[model samples]
Every structure is written in C-alpha cells, then in structure tokens.
Target: MKLLLDENLSHRLVGLLAAEFPDSAHPRQLGLRGASDQTIWDYAREHGFAIVSKDNDFRQRVFVEGPPPKVIWLSIGNAGTSAIAALLRSHAPEIRAFARSAQEGLLVIEKAPL
Candidate 1:
C-alpha cells in the first residue's frame, strides 16, 4: 500500500522506508508542504494513498467520515525519525493487512516498551 506521509513526519521517511513501503511519498515531494490537513486528506483519497501521521486529526476524521484513504496513526510520542521508521518497518505486515481489510479505518501504532 502506498503511504502519504504527513508533514509532521520526517520527509526522509519516504526514502528510508521505501524498500518496504514503495511508492510512499511526503507532502513536500508532492508540493504539499504546509498544506492543510483537509487538503492532504483529499489528496490521499484521490491518489489512493493511505495516510500516515502522528496527528490525531486524521484519526478523528477517519472515525467521523470512515475510510477511502485509510489512516495509520503513530501514537509514539517524542520519538526520533529512525525510531519511527523502525516501528513502521516492524509493523509492515500488520499495516498491509489493515489496508486490505474492508472494515478497518484506522490503525494506531504505539511504541513498544523497552
């Protein structure tokens, strides 16, 4: 599944995680840097990209509007970009499963305790 990484996430993540999440992109790459959440939401929907973000707004939107572009909400607070990438890489299988499912709208990914 293609992921549209939110502006809050490191744009480098698109390249860092490309092996696993090929075709993933950042807003800056799409000329969407500083774009509003609604614009990002609409872009993801139109482009068939699942939204990946640390923001709760997208999660809230999913609850209220349901899915066409699914959301992967990273709940790992204050983590480094590498840590975030690791978390996403480890959960790649689950993320793919969620994307393929018809009933799921949001997937909340939390950091596992050390």
Candidate 2:
C-alpha cells in the first residue's frame, strides 16, 4: 500500500520505508510543507495513500470520517529513525495484514512492546 509519512517523521524514514514500501512518500517531498492536518488527510484520500503519523489528531479525524484511504497511526513516542525502521521491519507482516484488513479505525503502533 502507498504511504504518506507525516512531517513529524524524519524524511530519512521515508527512504528506509522505501526498502519495503517503495511507493511511500513524505509530505516535504510532495511539497506539502506546513500543510494542515485536513489537507494531509484529503491528499492521502485522493491519492490512495495510507498515512503514517505520530500525531493523534489524524487518528481522531479517521474515527470521525471512517476509512477511504486507511491509516497506520504511529502512537509511538519520541522514536528515532532507526527505531521506526526496526519496528516496520520486524512487524512488516502484521502491518501488511492491517493495511489489507477491513478495519475502519486507527491502528496504533505503541512506543514499546507490551
């Protein structure tokens, strides 16, 4: 699935994700710097991208709007690029399943394994 990495995430993370999800992109790369949450959400919906973000605002919006372009809301806190990459790599299968699954809600990736 295509992904739109939020501005809160490192642009480098996009390149890392490219190894597994080649079609992913960052808002900065897309020239969407400082865009509002709704703008990001609308763009993702229009372009068929699943958003990956640390912000809960996006998750709230999703709950209010349901899914058209799904979301993988990263609930993790203060993580570095490597941490993000490791999580994605280790949980690639689960992530892929969530991306495909018909769950119309936020998918939270916690800061630490529970």
RMSD per candidate (Å) reads 0.6, 1.5
Clashing residue pairs in candidate 2, if any? none
**Model 1 TM-score relative to the real fold:** 0.98
Displacement of residue 80 (Cα, Å) in model 1 is: 0.6
| Clash pairs detected, candidate 1 | none
Q: Which digits, one per residue and each the tens of the lDDT, describe model 2 over residues 5-108?
A: 88998889878878788789999999999999889999999998889888888888888898866878886788789999888777778778877888655677
Q: Each prediction's Cα lDDT score?
A: 0.95, 0.83
Error in Å for residue 3 of model 2: 1.3
Model 2 stretches with alpha carbons more than 4 Å out: none
lDDT of 1 at 7: 93
TM-score, per-candidate, Cα-based = 0.98, 0.91
Which of the numbered candidates is closest to the native, going by highest TM-score?
1
Q: Output the lDDT of residue 2, model 1.
A: 98
Runs in model 1 with CA error above 4 Å? Answer: none
